[model samples]
Target: MFNGEISASSLQQISPVSFAYIGDAVYELYIRTNFLLPSKKISDYHHKVVEKVRAESQASYLQNLYPLLTEIELNWVRRGRNSVNKSPRRLPLQTYQQATGLETLLGYLYICDRPRLEYLLSQIKIY
Candidate 1:
């Protein structure tokens, strides 16, 4: 677990892909914790988690957050989007890029600004 101890300069040195890597895990834990009930079957939990974490779902979440992002936040997203060089075969390139952008931004906030990350995650429509 990151303690948010990294300096701003150091944070900048971290690659967008690296951010996306952490973001993917962070977002998954968040969704599983906040959105799912433990009473549900294990299979049900897996399906719901999968639905929320998919590229298409992530892209939509990014679109919803666009109007609310600050210039700095948008910059992080652009860095993530532009950093994408490859994507899974089943997904469209644009959708995968957008999803990566969202993940990158989430990862950035997770590392550099927990308050903002919580705010953005709260805004996500998971239902």
Candidate 2:
């Protein structure tokens, strides 16, 4: 079995915002790659995908879906949510920051080779 451990030292080295940055791309790529068809117009597909992948949308998703998360997952989300340093933004502060943390956790899990990403995606009752 693969020892799916993320080192504390490695986690400490990465900024929460940086994790969110990579995560936003990773999550969107997952959504776009999964939902967009080869036959569809690229522009139209991208527009449709962006609606779901934006920070606000993701934040809403996380809030509604928070109850479904495991204890460990909740901790990860909290770490990202409570991270002190942040980028400047025009969006609502709380939602945007929470969403950033959500994305960061998702990105972390993706890199950690954890099955939680797929599991959480599968459990999502919303589209």
Query: What is the lDDT for 104 in model 2?
Result: 76
Cα lDDT for residue 71, model 1?
100
Q: lDDT per residue, candidate 2, 12-103, as tens digits?
A: 78776677776787778777777655668888887878888877788887887688877877877877787734545767678777788778
lDDT for model 2, on a 0 to 1 scale?
0.73
Residue 21's lDDT within candidate 1 is: 96
Please provide, for model 1 over 67-98, each residue's C-alpha lDDT reduced to its tens digit, 9 standing for 90 to 100: 99999999989999999878899999899999
lDDT of each: 0.92, 0.73
TM-score of candidate 1 on Cα atoms, chains taken together: 0.95
User: Looking at candidate 1, what is the lDDT of residue 107?
Assistant: 92
Task: Give the winner by lDDT.
Answer: 1
